[model samples]
Target: MRSPARRAPRDADSLWRWATLSPALLLMAALGLLPVLNLFVLGFFDVRWTDGGSSWSFVGTRHYAALPGDPLFRASILNTTLFALGAVAGQMLLGFALALLCHKATRGRVFWRAVFVLPVLIPGIVIGAMWKLLLNPEFGAIAQVFEMVELEPVDWLGEASTALLAVIMVDIWHWTPFCFLLFLAGLESLPRDVYEAARVDGARGWQELRYITLPLMWPTIVVTFVFRLVLAFKVFDEVYLLTGGGPGTATEVVAFTIYQRFFTEDRAGYGSAMAVAVIFLIFLMLAAAAAARRRVQS
Candidate 1:
C-alpha cells in the first residue's frame, strides 16, 4: 500500500531481521530438519546390513505399506495407547493430591518437597533397575509384603497379564513427583487475595476450591497432562529393563518395536517407516496441544 520510498525501509528491515535469524535457521535445518529429511528418504528404501556389508536400494513405500496389517505393530500401538492413558491419568491425579498436601503443610516443607522430588531426580534406567530389584519376587521387600497376605510371591514384571501394568505403575511412581512439583509451583504462585476475598464472603473449602483453585490451575493441569502423555507414549527404558517387551511382545511399546526393526531384525527401511509414523502421531498431538493452549490463553 505504500510508495517506493516508504516500502524500502520496511523491506530493508525485514531483510535485516532475516539476516539476523539466518544462523539459527541454518542450525535448525542442519540439526533438526536434515535428519527428518534423511529419515523420509530411508523409509522408501530396502536398507540392509548383513555379514558386515551395508546397502541401500530404492523400494518405494513398501515398509510403510505393510504397517497397517502388521499384527505386532498393531499390538504395540494398543499397548502404547493403554500405557499413555493409564500412566498419565495416574500421575496427574496422584501428583495433584501430593501437591495439594505439600501446599497445605506448614512444617518441614523442604523435607517433604525433597522426598517427593527425589525419584524424578534419579535417571530412568536407574529407577528401572531399582524397581526391578524391589519387585524381584523371591527376596524383594514388595514380594515379602505380598507374602504376608498369603499370596506366596507375585512375579510382577514376568507375567504377560501384569507386565504392562507393572511398567505403568513404575512410570506413575517415577513421574508423579514431576507433576507434584509443577502443581505445587502453580498453587503457590496463585494470588493470595483471591482466597482472602473468598473467605470474607463466607466461602468454605469445597466452594473455594471449585470456584477458585480448579479454574486457576486448569492451565497447569493441561500442560502437565500433555507433557506426561507425550513422555508416556515414548516409554522404553523401564519396560526394557523390567519386561523386555516379553512374555512375548506383551509390553512392546512403539519405541521398542522401532528398536527391534532397526537393530535386531535389521529392517532399516521398515524401522524408518515406523519411526516416521510415530513422529507423525507425535506431531499431531503437539499441534492439537498448541491449538488448545492458544485457545486457553485467548
Candidate 2:
C-alpha cells in the first residue's frame, strides 16, 4: 500500500501517458477500425449509386453465399493461399540461410547486409516493373542467359503456367531481406555463453544449430512468418504490374480481385464481402498458428 501523496503522482503519470496515446488510438480507430466495420456492414447490403445519390438494401449474406459459387472468387482464393504459403516458406528458408551465413562471417557483414536489404527498401511497384523487364522473353537478363545456354526464352508473365510462379518468385526476392534482418537480429541476440557450454558438452556446428539456435530463434521466425503471411495474402502490385492477373486468371489474387470487383465492376457489396472474408480468414490462420506454437512450446 502506498501513501495518497505517492499514489497521486503515479496516477498523474499514468493519466499523462494515456493522454499522449489517446489521440493516436482514436485516429487508428477512425482510420482503420471504422472502415473495416463499414465494410463488414456493407457486405450485408446491396449497395448502388442512383442518379440522385446512393442506395443500400439489406440483402443479408447473399454476397458471402455467392463466394462459393463464383469461379473467379474461388480462383482468387486459391491463388492467394498458394502465394502466401509459397512466399512465406521461401522467404523463411532463404532468409534464415543468409542470416546464418552472415552471423558466421568474420568479414564484410555490413556490406552483405546492405546489399541484401536493398530489395526490401525498393518500392513494390518498382520491383514489379524491374522484374517484369528482367523476365521478358526477349532482351531481358533471363533471355540473355537462356540464349547463352541455347535454351528457349520464357515469356514468364505472358504464360498461364508460369505467371503465378514468376510473381511468387519476385515476392520472395523482394521480401526475403525482411526475414533476413529479423533472423539476423535473433541470431546475434542469442546467448554466446549457451553456445560455449554446448561446445564444452561436445556439440558441433550442426548439432548446436539443430538443438539450440532453432529452438531459441523459433519465436522470431514465427513472428516473421506471420507478418509475411498477412502481407502475402494482400499481394496485388506484382500481379498487377507483371501479369495483370492473367494470361487467363492464372495469377489472380484476392486483393486484385477485390479491386476489380469494387472499382472496375462496381460490385461494392460483393467486394466488401470478399474483403471481410479475407480479413476473417487471416485472423483464423494467425489464431491457428499461435495455438500450434503454444502447443509446441508446451
What is the TM-score of each predicted model, taking all chains together? 0.91, 0.94
TM-score of 2: 0.94
lDDT of 1 by residue, 194-289 (tens): 999999999988998899998999999999989888888898888888888997878999999999998899888999999999989988998999
Number of clashes recorded per candidate = 0, 0
Q: What is the alpha-carbon lDDT of model 1 when measured against the actual structure?
A: 0.91
Model 1 segments more than 4 A misplaced: 1-18, 50-53, 291-298
Q: Write the per-residue lDDT of candidate 2 for residues 221-265, one digit (tens) a residue.
A: 889989999999998888899888898989999999999999999
- Model 2 segments more than 4 A misplaced: 1-16
